[model samples]
Structure formats: C-alpha cells, structure tokens
Target: MKRTSLIIVSVLVLLSIALTACQPASTKVRVATDATFPPFETVDEATKELTGFDVELMNALAAKAGIEIEWVNIGFDPMLAGLSQCQYDVAIAAITITEDRKKDMLFSEPYINAGQIISVQKSNTEITGPESLAGKKVGAQLGTTGAIEAQKIEGVELKTYDSYDLAFLDLANGQIDAVIADYPTALGFIGQNSEKLTTVGEVFTDESYGIAVCNKNADLLKKINDGLAAIKADGTVQKLEMKWLAGQ
Candidate 1:
C-alpha cells in the first residue's frame, strides 16, 4: 500500500510539471520614456494621460504587431541606461539616432524627421540667426541635441532646462533671449503662444528620431521595424506627420 501511494504521488508531480511547461509566455512589452517633451511625448494636464505623436505611433505599432505594452515614465537622461539594464523593453521620446548611442543600444529605423531650430520673442528684432544669439542668454532641453547646439554658440549663456516648456516659459518671461529645440516641439510651444514667440533661424541641424530597443531583445527590434515599415508603406506615417506637424 505504501509503494502504491508513492507511485501515485510521482505521477501527480509529473503531470504538474507538464502542465506548467505547456503554459504560454507573456506577450506584454514594457515601454519607457521621458514624457515631458511635446508633440512627441507629453501629458495632458486635464486628463493626465500620455498623448502625442510618439505615443500615438507606438500604439499603432503595437496594434499592428498584435502585442500589448505598458508605458512607463522615466527621465530623459536615464532612458538609454534603463533599456540596457532591462528596466524597459522599449524606449521612445524623441530619441535622436547618434553613433554614440548606437554603440550601447539598438535603435529602430528613423521614424520621425526632426531637426533643431531657434525660437525667440517676436519683438526681438536684433537677432536674426544663430550668430545673433552669441553672448546672449539661450535655453535648451537638457541632454538634447538642442542643448549641444546651444553649447556650441560662442560666448552664449546656455541654460539647460529639463524640458522645452520650461525653457519656453523663461523666454516668454524675459529670462532668456532665445530657445534652441527641435522644430516640431518648438512649433508646439509657438502655437500656444503664437503672438509671443516665433521661429527665427532656419533648421540648424538635421536629426532623425528613432525608437530604442535593447540589444538583448533583437526579436523585438525586428518586430518594431516590421511594424514601422508597414505603417510607412500604408501612408499612416504621412497622416501622422500632417496631424502633428502641419501647423509647424
């Protein structure tokens, strides 16, 4: 009777193992980003929901790939590190594709054609271009190409803000002479205060925004690329560009 009971227990354990092995894997992808940027990623103050070009495009991509994702808010500077550390499976917040960043993380193909531009008060007639801002106060988003461009201005007082909104506020409040930021983002701010601000210099630098995916998860990279290609081929990309960047 003891031997019979032992045999029954072994069979039950084997069955449990088989059942566990047959369970499907989780399909949820965790996406992280710094949501402070606008026209690309920003929180709606009234509804407190993340909404913008990047958010919309990401949602579309996920739907096309038949996967679900949870968006996690993170700081801009730490986004790349977060992906490398496995804290997030995907990162997208106006992340410009650069050789330095490409060394550490795998980035998706260019999704957004973005470039840096300058914004100054409408009444500021003395400044016409990048050279005019020399030796004056300029604000830009921290850790961004805008900030990098601002730093290159000889003898300029560069104030790096955490977001372009704050930088624009300072410009509106007379704290700075001009702001350097991406054209689309700067345009969003100008739209809010069209009378107060206007873009002066032509696009200063050429940069393309890309989605960051971890090198460890190469499969995810392929999935995003495939989805992005489908969207671009289907004219969805043009529609999104018109929606977010038409006025800019």
Candidate 2:
C-alpha cells in the first residue's frame, strides 16, 4: 500500500510540472528606433527622454498588445542592422517601406505618409523646383529616401550627410545650395531656423513610413497590423497626424 501511494504521489508531481511547463511565457517586446528625427523620433536635449510621434505610437501599440517594450535608441544605420541581428523585435523609426528594404525585413502597414521636400536658404530664391536645382549642390542625409530622390535628379551635385541636422547645417552655411528631406523633417528644420531657411513650394516624391520587424516574426507582425487597423478605425492615427504633421 505504501509503495502504491509513492507511485501516485510521483505521478501527481510529474503532472504538476508538466502543467507548469505548458503555460505560456510572458511576452516582452523590444523596439529599436533612431531618435534623431524630430516629430517622428527625437531625444530631448535636457531630459534625454525619447519623445515624438513614433515613440508615442509604439507605446500605445504596446499597451494595446499587452506587451512591455524595451526601447532602444541608436543611429539610423545601426537600427536596421540591429533589426537584422534580432537585437530588437521591431523598428519604429520613420523608415520608408521600400522594395529594397522589404528584401530583408518585414514591414507593417505604413503608420504615416511622407513626401520629399526641398529646403533652401531663405536668401536664395532662384532655385524653386527640381529643374532649377540642376548644376546646384544638394545635401541629403545618408541612407534616406531624400538621398535616393536627389540622386535621381540630373545635373544636381548630391552630398550625403550622416544626419539631417548636419545636412541642414551645411545648407545654412551656404556649403550646399539646398537640402532635400522628408516634409515633416524639413518643416521641423525650417521651424528651428526660420530666419535662415525655407521650404520650396513644390514637394517631390511621396512615400509611406512603416515599422520594420524581422521577416520571420509573422505573429508579431500580425499583432502590429491588427493594432494598426484598430488605431486607424478609431481615427487615432489621423488625430496624431493632425497634431504633429498637419499644422506645420
């Protein structure tokens, strides 16, 4: 009888262990972003807090998905590498969903639409459009749609900088005739340097910005897509866009 009791007790212990093992693990998501672009992702100079549309959007998505996010801020170029290395589950930078990028990473539905714009010194009025920019030096941030767009234009001397701020700085110094950048980013730069720079009347190419995730993580991609749909349905995305992008 004692031997029989021992066997039953062992079986109960094994069953309990199996049940515990079968329970799902808590979900923790890590997000990486380039925090240098204002209105999308920028680091507060004083508080060092990452704040902008993308930051807020990611937080909202995490709340809705019932997951905690480990936010990692790094350079733009490194962000893509980190995503490929699986260092983060998603990238919320203002990354354009382009065919080339789609070759390596999965992209969620575009959170925002962006267009290329021209930024010229306030004193210069001769260059008004792409045709006028011929033979003039153009500045753009490296690895950005702006750079790619500028390269497409003939006769313009394309100069790539590490950051938009740097490109804007060169433009301010008269080293570059104009800077090509995303509309929101150009607006932010113009706002800060209203005395020195202004955006051209014409906008160039239009592109959609998306959150990038690992190509293999279909489950997380689905969660993000569902959350994005819900936000759009509730008009949250439009509201945010109006708050951040429309006025300027």
Candidate 3:
C-alpha cells in the first residue's frame, strides 16, 4: 500500500515538471505584414524568399528583443483583423499611424515618416495636384490612408486595388488617371517604370509609419520599442533606410 502511494506521488511530480518544461520560456512574438509592398516587404520573384526593409528590420528587432518571431503574411486588410484576434504580437508593415487605427490597436513610436503622393503616366500632363484631380479617376490600395484621402477629394472617382502593383497597373494601362500612395512606394514604383510614370507636383499629407501591437499586449510593446531604440542607436535603422529608401 505504501509503495502504491509513493508511485502515485512520484508520477504527479513528473507530470508537473513536464508541464512546466513545456511552457514557453519567453513570449512568442508573431508579426503580421503584407508582403506585397516593395522596398518595405516583398517576395523575390526568382528566389521566392521574402526580402525588403520591413523584413530586415523585423528580423533584427526579434534578435535584439531576444524573442522568436513567426511572420504571418496576409493581405493588408486582413492584418488588422488578425491583430484584433490576438494572432500576432506586433505588426510592422509600413502601416501608417492614423487616429482611426489607434482606437483599436496600440501603436509604437514612429519608425518612418512618410508622405502621400500622386503618380501618373509620364505622358499625361493634365493632372498636377490634388485640386487638379477633380473629375479624374484616382487609384489607391484598398484600406490604405491613401485610399481614404483620395475618396475625400470632390469630383474625383476613387478606385481601390488589392495591392500597389495592381493600382500601378491600372494607371499604366490608362484605366486610372493617377495612383495615390506613400512617397517611398511611389518612388520605388516610378523608378521601376520611369518611362511610364511620374510623380505629380509634390507629396500631399505628412504621415508616419509605426509598429503596431495589440492593445492588451503592453509587455510586447515595450520590448518592441526597446528593440527599435537599440537598433536606431546602433545605426541598423539608418543602414536599412539608406540601403532600401535612400538608395532608390
């Protein structure tokens, strides 16, 4: 009878240790991003490997924070939904920090300052600025600040595309008069198609991109902010900016 009691207690202790060992050492940080934005996040055509500024930055930040990162690549619109469901610990997809988004998600310090700009076919000379866009068909990525801004302009018909590439394609095919997007994306797109597209006038709105975390995950936010600061101080941020943004 004593032997049986001793065996049961020993089994219980082993089970407890096993359960404790299975618990994660540190919080697993899942990051969600739309990988279609080039110079920020994109998959290489030939190699099929994800590469760009956001990808590099996130990898570095994970190392700095001593956290393991599982990257979830979904469309831009679904990313917010995933974040809300607690699917990801953070999101860094060149997402603009806007007042509307703040109501649902927590935003980290601004990592990059960006501006909205209009890009048009090089041969089209009529459209020059926001005011000149009246009665024209303007294209922007769906669920983006650029889309919201474009829809606000009177007399301009706003068209939404799932990705910047599709928007640029519409502009290139003369299906849309202009494509409104962040300056970095516009610049990269224009560089790739210099003979086809040109930036009209100047950037319109001043905006900043930030890393997003769920409202309930304050601990994760702190780790990300600390990692960002460390990367900035160590010049990793500058190196990435120069390599991806300035180099273009």
Q: TM-scores of the models, in the given order?
A: 0.88, 0.89, 0.90
Give the TM-score comparing model 3 with the true structure, all chains together: 0.90
| lDDT (10s digit) by residue, model 1, range 1-248 | 99999999999999999999999765689999888877788898999989888988998888787668999988787776888777889999988888878887898999987898989999999888888987899999888889988888898899988777899999999999999998888998888889899999799888999999987888999989998988888888889888877875
Candidate 2 lDDT, 25-90, residue by residue in tens: 766888998887877888888998998888888777766766678889888888888787777899
Please estimate how well model 2 matches the true structure, expressed as its whole-model Cα lDDT: 0.86
Tens-digit lDDT string for candidate 3 (1-248) = 99999999999999999999998797677789998888899988999878899999988987898878888888998898778667777887889999989888999889899999999999999999999999999999988989999988999999998889899988988999999999998888777788899998888999999999998988888988898899999999999999999845
Q: What is the lDDT for 75 in model 2?
A: 81
Q: In terms of lDDT, which candidate is strongest? A: 3
Ranking by TM-score: 3, 2, 1
Which residue pairs in candidate 2 have backbone atoms (N, alpha carbon, C) closer than 3 angstroms, thus clashing?
none
Give the residue spans of candidate 1 off by over 4 A: 1-26
User: Where is model 3 more than 4 Å wrong at Cα?
Assistant: 1-24
Q: What is each predicted model's overall lDDT from 0 to 1?
A: 0.87, 0.86, 0.89
* Candidate 3 local distance difference test against the native: 0.89
